[model samples]
Target: MGPVSFKKLLLVFLTGILFMSQSITVKAEAAYLKSKDVTLMNIGTQKVEGKIHLKGDSKQKQIKVLLIKDEEKKWYELPLKEGKFDEEIWLTMGKGKYTAAIMIHEEGRKYSYGPKITVENVGEVNPFLVPVKHVESNDEKIIQLAEKLIEDKTTDREKAKAIYDWVTGNITYDYEKFGKHQEGDYDNTYGALHTLETKKGVCYDYAALTASLGRAVGLQTKVVKGQVSSELYKGYHAWNEIYLADENQWIFLDSTFGVGGKKEYFDKKQSELSHSKQEEL
Candidate 1:
């Protein structure tokens, strides 16, 4: 071919290459944008379920689901498996009108929040009884100790009592934690496992540890907030109650009081102990 014909052919080849590159870039951008927005579908009162659809094959990345109650200004993080999650979103913080909101987080990405949902009359679906951030009930230490305590106990009541006994016997009240709490150290940074390791904690720690152990042994146990007015202690207190499924009743146990060898508090009526139950969960 002549030089002019060859130059023209070269120009045509370059133009074709640029068009192909632009097409590839557009497709790549479209794929990325598609994976960014996730549709979070609210299914029912106790749970929210959703799926994430991506254009490419799935690879492991960090995924988090947050439960935010705007009224109480309380929020919790729910664990997700792979890229999907379907689970209960709130604590068993008793019966009330609660606003539920969800915020999803992926690794290296901004959080995307879903619309606010209202939940009412959450009677006994206590999701907080399960392992959470502060209540590490699924931790190996708590699990092993719980297994040892309730090894041969076949009944739920028996297992629950065993856990209560272990907590009262092994754990001690931490005066230092109390002082720190008074000084505004409110996080209770050391949770169930740390409490087990140290064998000492304040009322909140005691309740958390007891709840952890109780849950590890498969008992419906929850940390309760209330007021205690006794000679030795008279202030806001945290305790626990175990649900006796067979008896169809909740039995209250104060491990903190029991730690001081006050057996009268075990399975005692909330009114009888001069304890006013505020938050049931």
Candidate 2:
């Protein structure tokens, strides 16, 4: 082929590629959510923030959000506290296109579909800080409690220790629930505020409560699931791995086992020693 003809063909191909890219970006941005029930605040970013409002006394109703990234799909149900929810949903599947669908939970596994908002993630964020399915890290109560726990404490480590001390001291183990759980008669317990209010819950609850409190106070905290190996306890366990940013260190703690601070599980790499994580999620 002639050089001039070849150059013209190359230019056309590049122009077509650029046009396709621009089209995808436009579609993503255009899908920013707005409806009578659901109002999405931001899109074309790593995470989307939104609010859900259900008219008239819908107690315990939840807004179920489904995030679709390629073939990967995950759902998070945000509770409708007083018939409303203000939630920030993350794009956990990393940088790419995502589709978020909002549905109103009617009953057991029943949901009424709503808008499907498309997102183009153009940013990155700290995962631990973002609230997930069970961890209501951004709740006012959680934030207030975190502030209360970390009061008069300096440094991230100290703040984390204060929160740890509170959980270990205040919350008690739910032996009955644990027994039922082992027998397959009970599902996992609820999240942070519920634990705080009840003051008794199983290991999952303990980990979630710890994560919520830690995240609220600006510490990067994650809930880890595994099986215990210690002679004291030898079954499934949930614990916390917290990042102390200033210290540039990660420490593991188990508040459930550390009831009354009797167990030396706090900041001792207890998760690594006592439990082995299941194959990666």
Candidate 3:
């Protein structure tokens, strides 16, 4: 080819590549908004509101905002107006996480933007205060155990002490092996049966197992999630609350503490536990 023709072809190829690069950059950037521009606030009890500004070529299209509750597997969509959107979400006080997203429908395809919300425990309410439906048992072994632990002759304090001792002595705490993973089974009783059979579990598993066993024996029990600020450790922790039928109040029992090879026992009243928040069940 002639030198002039070759130079012209090279310039055309470079121009085409630059245009394609810009187009790709715009498309990639369209799916997400600037994170710093989004605003979120916990407005009132059980209510949170937020605003997200989305940037994209199809910004004029109708946008939908969703607040997804992980535990309940539910979604809440917000109303759209003009270029900005607002969302008001109602949440329960529990130990779980939530995610918020902005979705836009264009050319029959949907695109979503930043997940801008992370909700922790919202309020403080004892889980044991909620009414729990009693489960009747016909198993001979379970019935016999219940009868021995829950007979009319047993005082509330004695019953609670017995339950605490059984849980501490029977279950081994192993937190390292039971860290929460997104795909991990969390049927609330994931390790309960195994713990009952093998007598070993992590903090959460032990609390859940203890709660289940306590309920089986006709005592109201609940699992609580919180942060422990003891001398040895300071981080996320799990424990249980047992309703003292005679005293008409719930008491915190730390099976993990006992399982940690310590003689210290946690018979503190529910109000006395160092909990930033509490979630039921």
Which one is best on lDDT?
2
Report the backbone clash tally of model 1: 0
Checking candidate 3 for backbone clashes, the offending pairs are none
TM-score of 2: 0.73
Residue-pair clash count for candidate 2:
0
**Candidate 1 on 133-214: residue-level lDDT in tens?**
5677777888998999988998888888888888888888898879977897764555677889998988878888888998
Inter-residue clash pairs, candidate 2: none
Greater-lDDT candidate between 2 and 3: 2
Q: Please, what are the lDDT tens digits per residue for candidate 3 over residues 166-264?
A: 778767765545544334644332444456666777777677666666666667777777887776456777777788788997777878877784764
Residue 95, model 3: lDDT of: 47
Per-residue lDDT tens digits of candidate 2, residues 1-281? 99999999999999999999999998876655555366554443444333222222233346767778899888876656666665566655677677777776668667776656675665576778767667788889889989988889989888988988888888998889878987877545578878988998888898999999998878889898888877668888788889998989988788887883377677876447667877211
lDDT of 3: 0.56
Error in Å for residue 263 of model 3: 2.5
Clashes of each: 0, 0, 0
Q: Rank the candidates by TM-score, best first.
A: 2, 1, 3
Q: Which of candidates 1 and 2 reaches a greater lDDT? A: 2
After best superposition, candidate 2 residue 225: deviation in angstroms? 0.9
Runs of candidate 3 exceeding 4 Å displacement: 1-146, 150-153, 175-189, 269-273
- TM-score computed on alpha carbons, candidate 3: 0.46
lDDT of 3 at 170: 69
